[model samples]
Target: MSRGTSEAFFDVVEWAAEQPWSSGKVGLLGISYYAGSQWRVAARKPRGLSAIVPWEGMSDYYRDRCRHGGILSNSFIKFWWDRQVITNQYGRPGRAARNWGPDTVEGDLSEEELAKNRQDQNIDNAANHFRDDPYYASKEYDMADIEVPLLSVGNWGGILLHLRGNVEGFVNAGSEFKYLRMITGRHDLPFYYSEEVEVQRSFLDAFLKGDDRVGWSVKGKVPPVDLVLRKGDVGFNDAQAEKAYPRRTENEWPIARTKWTNFYLTPDKKLTRLEPLHTPPKKLSYRALGTLEDPSLIQFTTAPFEEETEITGNVVAHLNVSVSADATGPTPSDIDLFVTLRHISPEGKEVFYTGTAGDPVPLTKGWLRVSLRKTNPDHPKHRPYLPWREYLSTDRLPVIPGEVYGVDVEVWPTQVVVEKGGKLVFEVASGDTQGSGIFLHNSPEDRSEEKLRGQNHIVFGPKFSNYVTLPVIPPKYGA
Candidate 1:
């Protein structure tokens, strides 16, 4: 039934055996499907598979790809499996099998038809195992057993599946030589085909090829972690490409420089820097757009700034929220929140950073679906906002109307230096706002204008309240 998996494993093993090596050091390289497969072979502890470059690959199938906080990440998985796995014939030119629509069970289909069939099968499987079922668990690999060095790549816009997994794997993996590199952009967009591939190649060369030219040293002895901000068009050429990549050597995950500040959302649509407005606990409810699927998110902005501010760290939002019974369902509501930094020019045109200063700047950006609002008790310091720990025990708590529950959303780690007079903004909404297109409601079958409705309440007071903690790099005096 799973001949593909067995065949793929042996193919790599065969290739490894042919490699000329005084020391058994072979690295696995590829994106998505190839990267995903490496995990399976790596788990077996292949003799020569010393390092792995799992670009945009996930360790946990359930949390990362299969189910997004219990809801199926249907759109992403269905499309990927069809394009990359099912119909991928692998060096063959034959058409894929089609089984998606009502008519075909013949198993023999055209490439296009097979693609559609594969998509259908993927979605059907996802829908059937909608709950955190065994099928989902079966696909997941045990992270504790992975013993090789890993170089995980993550994207800021891949909120649906890839982003969280990269972060989680990089942090949780027991590998002593694990490194994380986060780049901003869409998930499927070319990382290998683009100049950014140099960064990846350097890592592979150093770890796998034993090349001392592409050393991981950067003035210090620390974990080689980088958070690359995709500015825009002005990227590094072949010569300076590898050197230009962002590198931040750190002793731990979610770098220590970050400061977590809780910004409270008010009923009047005002984002205040203060704590809870009152001690009695207040709740503000808005009319849920009822199509609870993709509710309108909230955007918070600071008054236009006059100086260049470098915000480089993890961001989390603490919301004391609730849902109107008339609006949503018994199942917990899932939505996405985004944090953006924009430079409002004197002409009032907002210039978003797409890359670095010398590189093209991004127009606008966001992170997504951070369901865990509670902080990990082991490393809870309201000072640096690092929401790395997952609180799996509190999954059943439902949001009640007029009731205040703390909901914290973690924004991916980023490094952006907003110039003088630019505005530092945070937009919290229910859906993806990066690309403008047809809006996708959560569930297509159970289409209901009423079931989608709900309201979010925010509480801000002195002691128990709302604020945003920022990592302020103190000025270098007398430099």
Candidate 2:
């Protein structure tokens, strides 16, 4: 809720260190909530807090969990709260399964009671505070004050909420002794994955026990950012699929010698490094509530690579766009863009990976609303890879009816080794597309659904030309 709530954790850390049997050393561990708490509490710069390994936790509550680029991120939050939160209440059915070792039990609740006992998700309370409000900023972990060593665990699938924060924490944190580990696939994999677990163990060992081996360097437990990046075709091995264990170690973070490639958007729905010379189509339009198959969707694809190309870290789209009045929702004030990154095989087929819901999925995703394009000017421009994101505002600026707006759509980070002959596809739409699942809002991003009136466009050409900046990691550096 507030930074005030962050105080309890430090209180616990201090109490633990004061205990006679305690070693006067403390470290925070756990996945998701447990991991997220580490960032919040550590920001306080607690006395006994020794180290933290925040595994797949969303550090920024507003930007990550509540909304994405000013639109409501519906399903995940509701499902997470209703299915996971409500189901584990003190007296709800299946509650015992979450209890401690010996006290766990099996119990069934009557329909009437189960229904009555369940609590409302109260999700509106979060949505109502849109933007960098006091409530959310309070919950935000102060990266500047976190001086202790930390091992920021990350996931490609965690881009929806966890991935950005994990990487941001590592990059912005005040700690001099910090490292990052990014695995390819599943979100929960980092928790118990052997390789991931080992990374965690060694990190914890160096801090907690002052003794350890493996990837760990004895000097304050620091290790380079180890990414088990996804390889083309074969992808990650089967055992490492869910957790994304690499066949071999790859390059470090802030990838040295990054080759920034701009795949320019074209009117023909294809992308190429070469900028178009002729007066190509100026714009492409799509219904704000269009289906995944909407022909108006603007798509760009590059030719299959002739050699391995590794793409890691933030993938952003630099675009010039505009919106129409009464688009998709009740009013004409907003326009939503859901951009997806997909893989295509050389043999005229699309590539797919298992999703978090155990279904086939693709690489990563990004989103943005035109009016919310106000960039965080303070965000370092040198880091072209990371997106400059601020927050949604209820009284935010409105999109001009026909004016082309230059904006950067921050695609979530993706880690993959594209095999020779595998093509990269980028799609932009008013709403969700084929590969944009898991992160799906269930509800459309535009709120003016009543009249269903609006059309948005992605413009390209000499004047409105746009392109996506990819973080191309050189071939053999991490292979």
Candidate 3:
């Protein structure tokens, strides 16, 4: 099958050669599997493949699909492989069914039956062969070898599979000309499909087709390297059939002139920026609360704003943490931390923006699993984190009741300008707030169930400080 896949790709390249006035450059673009295949073929250094846009594609399935943090991520792989790969292929017939049979559905079945079949397949193929297995390693290509320009796109809400790879590829790829554009929405949202397609077309026209008009169009839409902030209506609509949003460019990612202030989370549930006079470490722990319908979590909010504040870019939450049971060792077990941004109006109204049009306004939001918080030194500005790591069950580092450890959380990217008198709020919890709906109701779960279900606590102290880092955009035109 791999041989056939490779042959078909080569045949496509051969077909490209027949054109009389062929442009030497070819740009590959697609979502998920279609996007994934581009990486597979581009790594081969195919002739005429000038640039590639791999949206929501994983470079290492073993690290991304089969396991996350050394724990099997079967639930995701099983569903994706069946829906996007197997079912689509097998639904046809002939050789397609032969190749994709076990991976796809052949007949109408209950959801439970389909899930069981997927789980079975996941177990059969699950292994840590990524490092030692030849087949797995072969799929893990060196992005450094891909010299062409690249526009890597990702979905922050797609916490399980696509998000991590898009960020990693953009940060690690060898291409000098690379850009990372992330949207906050559902994994299967149509905006991503249509909007990203437009972005790819404009990008390809500029670099691959050498179209100056399209190049200028693309360049004009890009915000300045510095922080730029523009507040207005933004959302997705099928009516505007363009590939990329008509973004209001800012001077920088997090408008530079804007001040980044820290509002500490107090033990008494107070949100203050003032430092404690003789602060000592404080510890707080909550048992797992809520089911798929209810949630056990903590919510924090600042007083109503006196003026407008526009926030964008990556948000980091630094906290000292520990776990109740040292499941892995003497040290406390590591748990995931979920953070969210909410807007409370003077009239006691709650407004939350999904970053989609017609939703309430959003300042920003972030999430981080304590153990999965490893940063990439290459792109410090971007602050990339990897969730795939092994655990040492023998060496327990249980959280000492009062000891302080720093946990930096990364929020999903957003562009929002809060109006004066609007309140900014932050919440910290142990479980999936989306699944349970404690603060804001996000439809999807960013982290996996296995990761979110673990027991953990957020420790605070004079030595252990917890605060949020916000990217503020300065006023436009030097105002």
Candidate 4:
């Protein structure tokens, strides 16, 4: 699939360069699908491809879009495949009639013929479970091969999709003059906002036209990272309100001064900084096979803060967990852990962010399929706050009933300012809960009743301490 796209993009680039009216240097721009394809074609180093601005697009097809924590993200794939992809196929019969587009030039393809030509991503994704499988491997590319000048824009509220890819792409891409810009707002509006468009133009102009007005082409003249701080309850989905939040520049990501703070979870359902003082083992249980309509979960919350505390960057949850089968039911083979971080305002209101669909969401979300809990701490990308998982067939671990296993779950990166008297809540659930929006993982075949229906437990003891490590950012001196 990526090969076909890259070939077509290369052909176009070569064709444009030879035209009499051409500038001979091509730059790419756009958001979503357009931005995503830029990563693939740029990695190939096509002729005349000078620069790229992948605005809110994913780089890794498997990790960022198809699977989340090795669990198939079926809902978004279905929504995207049906409406955004299939309906626009080149030879669909009634496209002109329905005002979608013109019919095929030679004639429309029959339904049967069309079916043979295209792959249904929804079906293909659910059938393939690991990164090493041929289905996913064919789409893989090394971001380091991209040597073009790059500007990757990521949205903080796009927790379900594009956010991680943009950040990861900027980090891994071999571009010596790459920059990362983070934003906060609904997915579509922010990209077209006048301020954002200006940033995009200045970057493209500096690289493509050799105009270095903004110092983009001159290394060290401009900070490599531009971040939007999400502070205060600005109300979700309102662009103007979101603008009130401040912006800052950083020389590096995960900010070098980050204080990796651990907040332990107690049997009493509290999140505190102090470690437990010699307590007997305890566990909290929730019904398995939970759903959005009927969620089954547990929450551990922190007390009101004595002063303002800002939590920004990647988060990881270290938990000792196990699962048990119900009487007379099938044996449980796996456990799906859905973890969410929420902010409580000083007035006791839950602070929500603008999710991908403009829906109210918590601070951030993370997931893990217990059977795929294996991690490679030695991997170059692995960090204390963000553990790397290969999600390959060979990495699959056993999830036996009545056996406890310790796992580190990677929560998507996020930012928030917990005001004085405000609080933070750490929630663990068996299925999709609030803030999931359209990106859900509820496939009957993947999360079958025979496999996941059971009692999921979080064990707590001196030997098994459950805690969430937050990337706490202190204010810059004298700022």
Question: lDDT, candidate 2, residue 130?
Answer: 56
Please report the TM-score between candidate 4 and the true structure: 0.97
Model 4, position 139, has a per-residue lDDT of 81
Which of the predicted structures, 1 or 2, would earn the higher lDDT when compared with the native?
2
lDDT digits (tens) for residues 376-458 of candidate 3: 44543344222223233332233343344575665545455666766667777654454212222221233434323344566
User: Candidate 2 lDDT, tens digit per residue, 1-479?
Assistant: 34656788889898998999998889888887788788888888878788899988877776667678766676677767776656565445544455622222545667677667653534453445455565555566567788888888877666577877788788778886788877655565547757567777777777777765653545533345777656645443244444433644434566766677888888887888888777565788877765545533667899878887878767889888776765234545556777888888777677666455434566878887666777776766335666566564653666766777888888877777777888899988776666545555546423445423477878766677688998887655463
Candidate 3 global CA lDDT score: 0.54
Give the lowest summed-lDDT range of ten residues in model 4.
1-10
Q: TM-score order of candidates, best first? A: 4, 2, 1, 3
- Across 1-479, the per-residue lDDT of candidate 1 in tens digits comes to 12357356856775765678545677788776666666667766766677878887765665556544343445555555556566443322344324433333444456675455433545554455322344443455556566777888775445444565677667766676777876764344557455567867777777766773555533234355666643322232222443354544455556554444545555444554564345554544434442224446555556555565556555555555455454234433533333443334534565533232123333333333334444565653333354533434353344334555555554444455555655555554544443312212245432223433444434544434544455433222331
> Which of the two candidates, 1 or 2, achieves a greater TM-score against the reference?
2
The TM-scores of all predictions, comma-separated, are 0.70, 0.86, 0.68, 0.97
Total clashing pairs in model 4: 0
Clashing pairs in 4: none
User: Could you tally the backbone clashes for each prediction?
Assistant: 38, 5, 28, 0
Candidate 3 structure, TM-score to reference? 0.68
Q: Which stretches of candidate 3 lie above 4 Å from their native place? A: 1-23, 36-44, 55-75, 89-121, 124-144, 153-200, 216-246, 250-260, 289-291, 325-332, 345-347, 354-404, 435-455
